[model samples]
Target: MEISGYIALAVMGITLGLVGAGGSILTIPILVYLLQVPITLATSYSLVVVGSTAFIGLLRYRDHILFRKAILFLIPSALGVFAARRFIVPTLSNILGHLLLGQVLVILLIIFMGIAGYFMIKRPILDIQNHSHKKQNIKKSKVVLIGLALGIIMGLLGAGGGFLIIPTLVLLMHFAMREAVATSLFIIAINSFIGFVTNQSQFIASDWGNLKKYLTPSLLGMLIGLYIVKFINGEILKKSFGYFIWVVGIAILTKEFIL
Candidate 1:
């Protein structure tokens, strides 16, 4: 609504465009710390904004995506979302009030992002041509198992799982970085959409008005971010982005733990 809000929205959009997966990590913190939105409402708003932005990016880059490979991953991933949303999340939310649960969720997300970041930085270089050999060696069961695990994390945390998904696709399944990124977007979109729907009733009943105020600014930022993606070196920026997430996570945890 104000110039500061517009600036924040632009910053978030640029972050998403620069690094595809970390937009919500930035969005949530901006909403909570800067805008003074409650953690529960911020998380809900982050999901809708991030999901819509990801959907737009996916559409713009649809031709670059590997559809067949994405489907292979999405089927089990969707089932995992259903299980987590219908069974796991509701059970957790009932036991933990939304605000407390959001704090707990952010803690877990920090841990998850830390691990993903470590692997992204330390992973060994592989020859893409030899990937077929690696793929043949991976059992189908293991892939599904990993997919289910990632799906549950994505559903529970409201993350697109790009941090986890990209590495898994590349190292475990032997996809190239470009393909992995494209596939990761698809998986994130599917998982995020399902996660948002699962929590929609609560969001609708609470702060839908404030949520709507964020949509246009978020979408504008996302478009700018996507355009930047065309010119940027994503790999070089990932570690820096990870550090940014680490800082935000610590600040959020401290805020929740203290005042």
Candidate 2:
């Protein structure tokens, strides 16, 4: 792997530590474009990288995790991820003529990176404070649908879905910001790992040696991020990273579609 790849991985971990939700978004592109991993394999690698990092990132906010909520969310999510990886990805691979499945996945990933970038830059604060009491009363069906949708997205794009999950937890679930971020990590970890494990062939075939190269720096960055969070202004950092995501997304778009 190039030195740039290692630096990106560390930055990814640091982003996760700082924001708790957006860092793992960079994993796929980094693996594919920088580290020269095959795109399909990159998705699987993303699951490991994001899932493991998220699992580690959540340790700091363990007290804020809502296990019951995480469990409830996991059921549909796990099934959705399993379905996407086990069926949808393969089906798309075989059926899509001319357009490679890897290309399709990269396009989807770019679109999502744009969305994630928007969320990070805008950083809108939903006024759900008045709805605190009703948070628990949110319909179960809604949760299932949301979970299923997010799971499919995660499975398809190899993203942790933190950008989507955090907002869903905060606005719809009415969780506190701290709780939402923490629980987002928990959900991301399970969803990502479920996607990872579902692709058994990829799991077995993956280049573990290469994968470890990316993981080491990211984990170290996560620790650095945890410590840095205390000193930095989170909003400013988030906005800065959000713009960076857009720049990366544009570069991806150019590489994949235009150039």
Candidate 3:
């Protein structure tokens, strides 16, 4: 089971490296189900794995990143993540029954997975070629709202929320797909690490040795993905991964309710 979890982590890293999103989405479930980690502990583990792997990937795409846009989106997002991890998560954990909290978190994760799968599979049609027009239409307010929303989702789920970030960059910030993907990694790495660092209870509880074992293969796989991404069409890869996400989500749902 532990071996399987490690392999899954590698795949998650590869996915994140390939498209700059969707990788962290796999982290919590892999920890909880495959490694049999407790849900709350799994979330902390997820932040470490996802944040580290994403930072590595970001380095590979550093030249493509737009720092200004990354910062603009990051400020509110980081605040949101910190607040959620520090206050919201503990409050809810205490208020809810153990079984109920687990159920609620699982249900929310699955719902978010479904939403991410939908966005990946259904590529939005935009007049992205008209760069100036799109830039003119950019709404700074919406960007902040989206960033805050993404951060809340990340803090709660321990997922990087990259699925939403890429779209926001592309559609609102007028970033080309490559640039959006690169920038997404930057935001994810920063926000995830911030959330993890601020949540001292969870961070202190995490097992560094165990995390290192899980992280090794993931980092290697990320390197492989970075090499292959140059040859593959991202759109095609994203759609295929989206279908895979739906399948995994359905399987998880079945296990949770039926099995």
Kindly indicate the candidate among 1 and 3 with the higher TM-score.
3
Q: If scored against the real structure, what TM-score would every candidate get?
A: 0.82, 0.92, 0.93
RMSD of each: 3.3, 2.3, 2.1
What is the C-alpha lDDT profile of model 2 across 1-259, one tens digit per residue? 5889989999999999998877888998888888898888888888888888888889989999988876667788888888999999889988984258888888888889998988888745454345454445677788789889889888987889898888777766777889988999888888887887787565542478777877898889888898889999888888888899989999999987898
CA displacement after TM-score superposition, residue 86 of candidate 2 (Å): 0.9
Model 1: lDDT to the true structure: 0.69
Clashing pairs in 2: none
Candidate no. 3 TM-score: 0.93
Which lDDT tens digits does candidate 1 get at residues 35-102?
A: 77765566557667777777776776566677776666677877787677778766877899776777
Model 3 C-alpha lDDT per residue in residues 166-202, reported as the tens digit of each score = 8788877778877888888899889878987887454
The TM-score, computed over Cα atoms with residue i paired to residue i, of candidate 2 is 0.92
RMSD of 1: 3.3
lDDT of 3 at 99: 73
- Order the numbered candidates by lDDT, best leading: 3, 2, 1
Q: RMSD (Cα, Å) of candidate 3? A: 2.1
Number of the candidate with higher lDDT, 1 or 2: 2
Candidate 2 residue spans exceeding 4 A from truth: 97-99, 126-138, 204-206
Name the best candidate (by lDDT). 3
Total clashing pairs for each candidate? 2, 0, 0
